[model samples]
Target: MKRRSNLLTIGMLALLVYFLLPLFWLVVASTKSTGDLFSSFGLWFTADFHLFQNIGQVFTYGDGVYGRWLLNTLFYSVVSAGGAAFLCALGGYGFAKFRFRGNSTLFGVVLAAVMVPTTALAIPTYLLFSKIDLVNTPWAIILPSLVSPFGLYLMRIYAQDAIDDSMIEAGRIDGASEMGIFFKIVLRSLAPGIVTVLLFTLVATWNNYFLPLIMLNDPELYPITVGLAAWSSQTAGGGGSTGDLLALVVTGSMLSIVPLIAAFLLLQRYWQSGLSAGGVKG
Candidate 1:
């Protein structure tokens, strides 16, 4: 038993190190000057530091374009995550609680949608948005992200246990309207599941690259993922100023991850509860 426990501990530590090592490298690399990056050390300490200088250059270079991308990413992430969570909650509540026509069939279709890859739908979505002149706008990203099939599925499963039908009925019996009952009773009860869905949507929208790559053409409208890719390409192409875009990209990647980390920390308890309660029948 002791041998097995030691082996398992070592294995888990190795896996943790494997995932964190890349992020550690990015942090150290972003702080080092270009010369020091290549010559001084691969994973060791750098003799010459350029952390502040690189950050200044990242903001100032290209007329502060990185700031624009940062804002766009935030906007897209907030809207998509919040919208998707709300929509999923509504849809899931309706499917789980209401006795509507063809609810099972409709839910089956939604389940099928969960099986479909978002990437496969990107081309059709781009075409549809382009026809409506919504392409190249943040809506192009935000709208599609709001339609999360997995979120719908998660909410459906979560709503089954997270919310009680008796509570909703009591709310209705207490002179509450349908909307009032749903908003006041059901939604409040499903808070944990809502946060879970929000986190899922936020992460997906934040890291999404391929959909934005196909939907958008204007660089000014690019999310951070797309913007970073463009910068990487420019690095390869020897673009103007020869600024340390690599460092900026690295620092920006770190900055981009901060919001997610903060969000997880804030919502971890709710997320854990929601997941644990999902599909757990009374």
Candidate 2:
């Protein structure tokens, strides 16, 4: 038993190190000048830290392009994720609670849509949006992101367990409308599920690169991921080597991950409890 425990502990530690090594490297690399990044310590802190200088350059380079990218990303992430979550909740609630013609068929279609790779549809979506003159706009990203089949599925499953039919029936008996009952009672009970869905959609939209890559053409409309990639590529190819955009890219990558980490930490309990309840009931 002792031997097994020791082996398991070592294995877990190794896995943790494996995952964290890249992040540690990024932090160390971001502090180094381009020259130092290649020449200095690969995994440890530098003797001379240039983090502040690098950050300044990251903002000032290309006329504050990073700032624009950051704003675009925030807009896309918040609008798409929040909108998608609300739509999913509505769809899920309706599917779980209400009966209508072709409901099962529509849900089956949604399931099939979930099975489809979002990346695979990017080209077609681009073409469709182009025909409507919506390409290169924020709507190009937000509209597509607003329809999350998986989120809808998650909500349906969550609503089925989190909300009870009896409550809706009671609300009806008390002369409450469907929307009122949903808003007043069902929604409150499904708080955990809503948070879970919001986080999932938020992370998905925030990290999304491929769709935005295909949809938007204007440099001014670029999200941070695409914008950072452009800068990183240029820096990697030694376009100008103006204060190590590459280093800032590393740092920016590190910074971008912070929001995701904080969100998970803050919502971990709700997400876990929601999943546990859904699983137990399902």
Expressed as tens digits, the lDDT of each residue in 1-282 for candidate 2 is: 999999999999999999999988888887887778788779987888988888787788788988888888888888888898888888999999889999999999999999999899999999999999999999999999998999999999988878888999999999999899988988777878778788888888889999998888899999988988887778757755445676888777776777788878988887687677778867
* Model 2 score (lDDT): 0.86
Candidate lDDT scores, in order, read: 0.86, 0.86
lDDT value, residue 134 of candidate 1? 96
Clashing pairs in 2: none
Among all windows of 10 consecutive residues in model 2, the one with the lowest summed lDDT is 236-245
Query: Pairing residues by index, what is the TM-score of model 2?
Result: 0.90
Evaluate candidate 1 by giving its C-alpha RMSD to the native, one decimal: 2.5
Shift of residue 54 alpha carbon in model 2, Å: 1.4
lDDT of 1 by residue, 175-203 (tens): 99988888888887788888989999999
Instruction: At residue 185, give the lDDT of candidate 2.
Output: 87
Question: On a 0 to 100 scale, what is the lDDT of residue 149 in model 2?
Answer: 91
* TM-score on alpha carbons, each prediction: 0.92, 0.90
